[model samples]
Target: MGFDQYHEPPEELSQKVRTFARMITSLIEEAEAIGWYEQRISVEKDPQARAIMKNAQGEEFKHFGMDLEFLLRQKQDWRAELKEILFTTGDIVKAGERGEKKVD
Candidate 1:
């Protein structure tokens, strides 16, 4: 089976790298599912159907968080940088700049 997630030759990459790539792909897929659900929910007129889509979207959000946490655990520097950038209010650009400096 072809793994489209790998940019490099799979044979040359470490097992850990392969797993990371898989999780990254999973994260992307979950984000896409969330966006698709958002669009569907926005257009749907039925309240029941919209509620179901919202529930499904919540699951996707959870999956995305799990995938991200896994990837973050694998990369400490990334975790440190994100700590500075995520879950904070005011001046997102400043937070990112601070994160960049911390990582650097």
Candidate 2:
């Protein structure tokens, strides 16, 4: 019920920008949920509760991935940068540097 996501006047922004902002908010919420579940699972001693938390955490992961894919599809440079850094087997910093080069 809060319009905290919009730093500027929402009426002045394009529909596409609004949609992007909403997705970014969703992505952040999903990430926070995932982290919360992780912490809960770590402290939870009950096996059933832990299992349920893990399952919910996995669902959050899926949502996060979907949001990321949607955002990446909207930006070719983001896709290229992620492609260079993600799923690779070398140093991550080096891969990020490579990704930056791709963006540059």
Candidate 3:
């Protein structure tokens, strides 16, 4: 089966690289699912159905976080950069600038 995630020849890519690509794809899918759930929850008339959608959205958020953490573990520079930006309260643009400098 052809995997669309790889821009290069899959046979030439390392196993680690292939795993990274799969995880990245998974992350994107999870994020998209979260957005879809958000829209559904917003318009849902049934309270129980909305609650279920919210719960599912929460799971997607967890999946996205896990995938991001895994990817970060593979790249120290990325982890370092995000450390300067994540979970901090301040100007987002400035935080991003700091993160860029850290990676630089």
TM-scores, all candidates, are 0.96, 0.96, 0.97
Cα lDDT of model 2 by residue, 1-104, tens digit: 55999999999999999999999999999999999999999999999999999999999999999999999989899999999989999899999999999899
Q: Which residue pairs does candidate 1 place in steric collision?
A: none
Stretches off by above 4 angstroms in model 3 are none
TM-score of 1: 0.96
Model 2 is weakest, by summed lDDT over 10 consecutive residues, at 1-10
Q: Cα lDDT of model 2 overall?
A: 0.95
Off by over 4 Å in 2: none
Which regions of candidate 1 are displaced past 4 Å? none
lDDT of 1 by residue, 40-90 (tens): 999999999999999999999999999999999999999999999899998
User: Comparing 1 and 2 by lDDT, which wins?
Assistant: 1
The Cα RMSD of model 3 versus the native structure comes to 0.7
Query: In order, how many clashes per candidate?
Result: 0, 0, 0
